[model samples]
Target: MHNWNDPGGKGSACQADKDRKDATRIAGQLNIPIHIRDFSQNYWDDVFRHFLDEYAAGRTPNPDVLCNREIKFKTFLQAAIDLGAGCIATGHYARIRKHQGHYQLLRGCDPDKDQSYFLHTLGQQQLAQACFPIGDLRKPQVRELARQAGFATYDKKDSTGVCFIGERDFRKFLAHYLPAQPGFILDTQGHPLGEHPGALYFTLGQRQGLGLGGVQGAHQAPWYVVGKNVTHNTLTVAQGDAGHWLDALRLLTSQPSWVAEKPPGKSFLCTAKTRYRQPDQSCQVQVLDDHCEVIFEQAQRAPTPGQAVVFYAEELCLGGATIEATDAAFGGLEAST
Candidate 1:
């Protein structure tokens, strides 16, 4: 479903009009019937609202994951079924296959464009009723096919990041909804280096938009966000791009949605990605009563809480969980023995 976040399209230069026009032309070309459904309220309530709440609570959340689970699959999929459609197809670059009376989600053939990372939350029912027509095709092949079809959108630039936040200053956008609570930016030694607009506005390991380039008495080394204290309204930073405090070798997650109706086992070895486009990292997972623990084979950098961590076995996407906390070991850990 297309986003209805922009009303009248004034703020974004009439992008809504252009999208509608392109969709209408394409539908006409294929002789397929199209319906215009307003899902503005749904998006605001289910996706964007939660995005704001997560940020307010001192976490960075990925809206696309929630949108795929709540709006795209749940709301839009149900709507399509009501229209007498047997199954709905979309442009998502992921594949679904049935094995032993169950459906399995797989990565797209185009590794660079694989979107199963965001689709890991989907369960058996959603996978059964969903179709990804381009899952087996590479991106260039799809683009060439579209070019052969005389479609105007064949060469459209791919959109990245959060679509609603498009090209606008993200910090400024947050300021519009969350009032700035200016606080001191302190160094690792508890020395105040400068001031920041808000601790909630930044995330761990972030080095940009900190506005600390001109601080005196600070070394020439760059600063990285290592800690955020909302209670004291303080932001603690550390110098050096390879700061030891941001290393996260283990993390905890909320309950996960598994593709096989349960985790592969009580504990299993799998490759996982903590963020989109991140290369798979070797990790060992242990399932618990209320949460799951992941121990990385190698120390991970900045596995931020509130982001989704997806598990993979070869090309199969097993499932995913929302990161709850990480052992961001400060000053490095000593040997236990």
Candidate 2:
């Protein structure tokens, strides 16, 4: 496996010191010669710069997804093939199956920990050569398997934050490069109700940290972030009322992928999840040449623009795409065509 050391080979200087140490320990235990490349400063700096550039362009790019598709699968796969590796695998929670001479993507059995959404950006070729050892098992089962196998990370707390940057508060990490700018907090009706520290700090459906108070005042009933206008520096919010939060939406997806032999045509029924943590909701899917749209049966809240919307038909993962737009007006509709 190929891994890059974060800046200065500073296994000692960076927050990822523990990871480096763990990697070393694992390699020693497995008797594997781990080759470490020192891209260090240039690699990390370039990634962060690209992230800021995308965000500034009003596009919510999932950096992890990009890294996996572009670097890990594409670049690393080629390198591994050159070195005569038979196959590659990762800790991803996605399953691959062969159907009609094509590779299909499926959700891991662990409902709560499925990560097929992150792997949605991968194409057909990558899916063919990838393996997921823990795909069929739940988190607890994986831990038990690890314990039985005598692996040290059997009980290691799940790693949080970005792939190699280690766990840091997202706002704090971004603030280091992108300073927060104060913005206006508005109600759904475009009424100014409060002030936000920065538009970049908040996301759709976020409830905490708005600093709004009172029993019956603006944001008094535990407001949820509804929308954001980055250009105007305004964040729209709503109370946690069923009527205010959305139940359904018209999700415009760009650059869709299919793991099946045939693409589901326009207006087909399926289940989908807007966020990784959310349960798959019953919905109808429509496939276009370049995009697919989903309309959930029940209203879902905070379908953020930059996040993935993964679709499923029972156990199989059809595909997913980044949420491009949402319509509050279409929330109560039976279907969104």
Candidate 3:
């Protein structure tokens, strides 16, 4: 098991060292020689220089996705090859299948826990050397398998917060690096209702904790966050009408990975998922240069930017991309374009 704990900030080296000590101690007890690589200083100084700089300027960065593609798969694979290791393994829940003469990446069987979407940025070469031991199993089956193998982490609570950086309150974490700016909560029609602590603390589909007191409609029903006008520092709220959420979305993704022998011409039908936990929805996928457009047969609510959009056909994962934007105009099946 490899633990890459680089938080991309000052004093991360010390933290990484402490984590390594703990990991080494545990590995010794289990008679496993675990290799712990400390890349904190290098990550902050090198791999994430631009992202860290952007965060310093108050921009949110998806460091987890970047780490998987650029560092763990790219740099670490090279290091492993140099060390005479033929394959690299990870805890990612994606699958690899041999097609024709090449390996292709696919979503795991557990739809609720599939993580292939975040891995779409990886190229064909990385997929060839990657191994996901738990790809074919469900969450419960994985736990049972771990228990049968006498692994203590069988019952371990799922880790939260940013990957490797450990747990932290979302606002507190961002506040450590970015300045907090208060924002307003507004209705779909632009009526001010309440205030939010910061724009960065909220997401496109969030529902609770807006601190909006005078929210009038849906007196008994809960409200959900439908959208956010980042430039104006305003959040749009709506009654928990599942119908008003989302139906279709257009994404602008960079560095796409295709598992197909040849790109599908014009459009093709596939099972698409906007979020990890969501069941695969029927949709038509159109691959474009630098991006792919997904038109869902059913409206999806609050398709947030920076999240992944994965596609599947039966058991094969065609590919996926980051959701750059969404449109509510296609709110229902009949409204699809």
Candidate 4:
């Protein structure tokens, strides 16, 4: 199984050493030799660079999705093939099946830990070459099995946010790659309430780390980030539920890809999620050659651009696309005073 050593953005330089120790210990127990591969260069080119570009564009991106498609499936898969391997496997909580001469990507039986959303970019080629040994098992079941088998990573805490950030302040880590652009924090009426280190550092519906306490004309209610303008270098905040202002009913995405290479039909209805762990939302889809448009039955909050929208039908993963634009009003996000 492949475990990425470098995840991106300020990942510890000694990450490889840590991985090697665990991998060596486990391989020794299993009486198998482990070959450690360094794909950090490939990771930077295919995953980290794209992540930085998306953030620079003032849009949040999911690096795990990029890493799965680029590093795990593309680069690592090729390396395994070169080493005379028939197929490669990972510990991802996803499943693959062969039916009617086509590989089907399915969600893991462990619903709470399902990772199909991150694997949506994978196509038939990757699916055919990929394996998920624990997809049919729940988290606890897998952990118990690993305990019985004496595996070191069985109890490893799941990484959150960006893997490379690794408990480090996200703002501080990102500030290193993208030079800080200090700007004013304003309200809906263009009133400057406070100052922000950078407009690109925040996301819609975010409340913490804003440092907006005791601003003039601000209400006693807690403030939330409602909008941002990267070009103009400003952030917009609103008290109370700023989330409603960021709700999006429809979104447009770039370069859609399907597991079967073509969608069920040119237009179809299916379930989708704007982010992981979000309940599957019923939506209507319209696929174009260049992009696809999805209209949700209910408004979704903060469907950030540069993140992916993954499609599903029952347990089968159809595919996904990169969110590009949303229909949210967002307090007239780019409006300048």
Best by TM-score: 1
Which candidate model has the greater lDDT, 2 or 3?
Answer: 2
After superposition, candidate 3 runs with Cα above 4 Å error: 1-32, 41-63, 139-150, 216-220, 245-255, 260-262, 329-337
lDDT of each: 0.86, 0.70, 0.66, 0.85
Candidate 2 residues 1-337, lDDT tens each? 3234544343324545566777788888889977654444443554556667756644566777666766668767776777787678888887888888888888888877788877776667888888988899899999998789777888988865565545446666566667868888877788887898777777666788887776344444678776677788787777866345544456776767665535677678988888766777998888877787777777677576767787888888887777777765422223445
User: On residues 227-286, what C-alpha lDDT tens digit does candidate 1 reach at each position?
Assistant: 887778788888887447887878889868898779999999999999888999999999
Write down the lDDT that model 2 would get.
Answer: 0.70
Per-residue lDDT of candidate 4, residues 1-337 (tens digit):
3333433533653554566788899999999878778787787788888888888888999999989888889888998999999989899999999999999999999999999999988998998888999999999998899998979788977655665666667887888789876899988888888889999999888888888888776677888887888998898888887766688888888979899998888899999999999999999999988799888998898888888999999999999998988878763323112
Q: Pick the candidate with the highest lDDT.
A: 1
- Measured over all alpha carbons after superposition, the RMSD of each candidate to the real structure, in angstroms, is 2.2, 3.7, 4.3, 3.2
Sorted on TM-score, highest at the top, how do the candidates line up?
Answer: 1, 4, 2, 3
Off by over 4 Å in 1: 7-13, 330-337
lDDT for model 4: 0.85
